[model samples]
Target: MAGLLQRVKSKMAIFAHRKARGMLDGEYGSVFRGRSLDFDDLRAYVPGDEVRDIDWKASARHGSPLIKRYVAVRRQTVLLVTDTGRNMAAEARSGEVKKDIAVLALGVLGYLAHRHGDLVGLVCGDSAATRSLPAKGGEAHLERLLKHVDSHANLEAAASRIQDQLHHVARNVKGRHLLFVVADEIAADAATGQLLRRLRAQHEILWLTVRDAELAPSRQAGTDPIARGDSFSVADSTFLAWQPATSAAVQAAYTKATAERDAARKAMLRGAGITEGEVAGSADVITGLFALLERHRRAG
Candidate 1:
């Protein structure tokens, strides 16, 4: 147990290091720079154009008109709501868990938001709304938020009532802010859609569903029974077991169900005029977030 805990901690540290470096390097585009006010390029300074923007040297060299281009100014607030519910504890085929993946995703986003000088805030919800960290600026604020998230065992309880939490968040946050939700694919439902619509009316929302490879269809079959050692309780001294054939069938059904849920979730997001995506534990969350951020910047 101690060894596994250490490994998890080490993995988290490494992920954080890589993520922090990526944000610092600004490899994911310059959206974090907030829109620029100064002209970046100068085409031909058209007639009636602002004379102040004329590039005299370029005009002399080209023997034609030239104008200075300035950067646009765009600033936004980002809010991250992470569902630390019981379902997020499922273990992926590679031994990675959904809750761990959620933390990594949240950490990366927090780091990126802080680096970009955006106000960063977190709303963690489970069976009920647990913690609400109002959007704030500074690395210190992000650190505090991350620490609060890391200290809690979100999966210790039963499935989370995300819809209720969303309603609560909507009531408290009443502005145009970027909202990112991280959760397992299984928990998204009809209520989630309703809440999404209400929230989208006031904010830019993005949904990221984390999944495990074992949950996929291709790897759902095998001869051995799916079993794991008893850790939650000592009442049973033997490993829990289920026939591979049965397990495979069950997994297939789950996969189908999850797919349907994902489709529904996507449609709801689309209806809300929001963008969404899924990230597997085996995949790179950093890359996923970078793509989302770029898309959001372009849309802006």
Candidate 2:
């Protein structure tokens, strides 16, 4: 099989054509608020650039906003958190396997951390158990992390409970770290919200949600084969979709429920001060992440 990290690099190479590679790196770097006393240089202030970095005198003299850049004095750790339950083994909105998209997202971020000279670790598992890999450097270790996620998440795995993984981080992990979480659409709850707030206080967090498959037909006629046939829930094999269920009223109701659910999820994350992005498939992973990082940089 082709190496997973290599696939991530290939996708990034394709994306580099549209945008400078450094832009992605810069966006990722800006997520961390930590700065060094050593000055690097000054650059024109972007929308998401921290206002604290602005040099008032320099801006006045230059007649424009400019941010003071600094050389990073410490190597930061990025912990990739994900759900490896059977739910991830289901299909995404783009008809690709959700776990594949998850792996791609994780690999891209891991590679960026590798390039930035930061340690990369992983925390992923199903409801049965949560697992962690010690933070370390190197592409080989990252490759191993990706491989572990790809191989373990399958149809037979246990159900997903992202809260469990978050609890693990809250209880066991120490020190400030950048947490990049990738998982499916998680239902919002009081306990989950409280846990997120606690974690947000301790670590910088960015979220990527893998979109679930469309059960109702979109405007594009007959494009979704999965929707045309009977759909089964990955968690319990419960029937989710069928031809009769695609009636206009049913679609309308489904649409309403989906919207409300998404809104609640967004609200929960925003309340916890976490920036979120969504990807329907592997194709959108790079762009989705770029937007996510940019949002994180802009977020208060």
Candidate 3:
């Protein structure tokens, strides 16, 4: 099989064509505002680069926008947090496996962190256990992190409780770092909200929610492919299928409930001052991350 980081780079190459080249790097770098006065060098400014970093005199002399690079006192650490559980083996909104989407999302961000000269680490597991890897540089280390997430997440894994991983990070990891979380559509609750707030206090966080598949199909979408086949729940033995003959009232109720639940999840993350993004499939991971990083930079 092709390496995961290589797939990430391939997606980036496609994204680079759509947007300006190196725009992802510029956007990713702009999020962390802390920088030392020790000047390293100057380079051409990309579209997403912060305006404050533009050297006016240098730009005038060089005849284009230029951004100043600084020699950092310490390298930043990016913690890739995710869930490895049966839930991830289920279908996504795009009719693809949630675990595949999660890997793409994680790989994209981790690759960006690697390109930024930052150390990348991973914290992923199910409710039964959580695991952590030390932060380190290099593409080989990043590939190992991605492979771990890809290999461990399956239908046979334990149930997902993303809070466990967050708690592990809160208790064991020290120092401020960038925590990038990719997980399923988690329900909102008081305990999880409290834990998120606590984690937010110690680290800058970015959340990517892998969109889950719809449980029921609406009457109008009766001819959809998903509606033709049966669906099984990973959380339990209960099986559900998209019924074309389902009542409009039931569809409306499900729509309303889903909207409310999503609102609550967004509010919970917002309350903790963390930026959140959503990806329905692997195809949109790059665009979704670009939007996520842009929003994070704006929030900061």
Candidate 4:
């Protein structure tokens, strides 16, 4: 697994890319400017500490004034927030598993942050429970973060419970950071929109949706065959058996519905000042990421 991560890491040679500079606020450096604009830690006030850096509440708690120590402003934190629910277990049109895509994608982002000397963090889970790792830098820390998602984060669960996970991240992560969310396709809705907007207020959110042909039926033609082991559901109708062929009209209707659903989802993200892209299969993984980064660069 570590070897695979290293291969992906190598493909992310962002130094040649102009957008990498944008990650650090257009500075002429290769590193990402971290959450230094936000306070890092609180220590007992020092003689030369700035008065504005003093934490009054901490001072009361310790019976002496304490100073907030912010990490280097040039360093940034990259948090990978993912959902390992059942939907993630589905197979993508590229023939790679969604869970594998998620791991690789996470590896890509984590590797970029690692290369730039930025801290890497994670918040991943399903309906059962959500786990979080505070931002920390280094090869060892990045490896552990990747391993946890590869091993502990399961793919058999039901509800992704993304809203809950979002709230968890919001409450646990301190200050501003670079947040990447990898999850199933989100249907645009008020509740999720509100939560995303709130998170956007405090962090740079880059949305990644794991795409699979099975998830949204295209307008093409006959019913798409659900691979023997690949089954999915909509509402309460679970498709466990292989799918049968459908007329062109049926496929069109399905396509129309999916288009509308996708449009609404995009609209919601736009409203929240978020942009999303897809990671389809193993082959498309690296290319998709580079393309996504290009978009981020242009946006910045």
Best by lDDT: 2
* Clash count list over all predictions: 8, 0, 0, 2
lDDT string, candidate 4, 44-96, tens digits? 88788789778898899899999888756767778889987666666766767
Compute the lDDT of residue 228 as modeled in candidate 3.
Answer: 52
Each prediction's RMSD over C-alphas, in Å, is 9.1, 7.3, 8.5, 7.8
Where does model 4 exceed 4 Å of error?
A: 1-4, 10-72, 153-155, 215-237, 241-244
lDDT of 2 by residue, 1-300 (tens): 779999888888886664666788888877775532358999999999989899999999999999999886578889999999999999899999999999999999999999889999999999999999999999999999999999989999999988899999999999888899999999999899999999999888999999999875333346464554556788898865366555988878978999999999999999999999999998898889889999888874
lDDT of 3 by residue, 83-166 (tens): 998899999999999998898888888888888788999999999999999999999999999999999999889999899999
What is the lDDT for 64 in model 1? 91
TM-score of each: 0.66, 0.83, 0.82, 0.72
For model 2, give the 10-residue run with minimal summed lDDT. Answer: 216-225
| lDDT (10s digit) by residue, model 1, range 4-109 | 2243345545654765556533633454344335458879877898887789999999999798887754546678787666656666445677677777677666
Ranking by lDDT: 2, 3, 4, 1
Candidate 2 segments exceeding 4 Å error: 33-72, 217-229
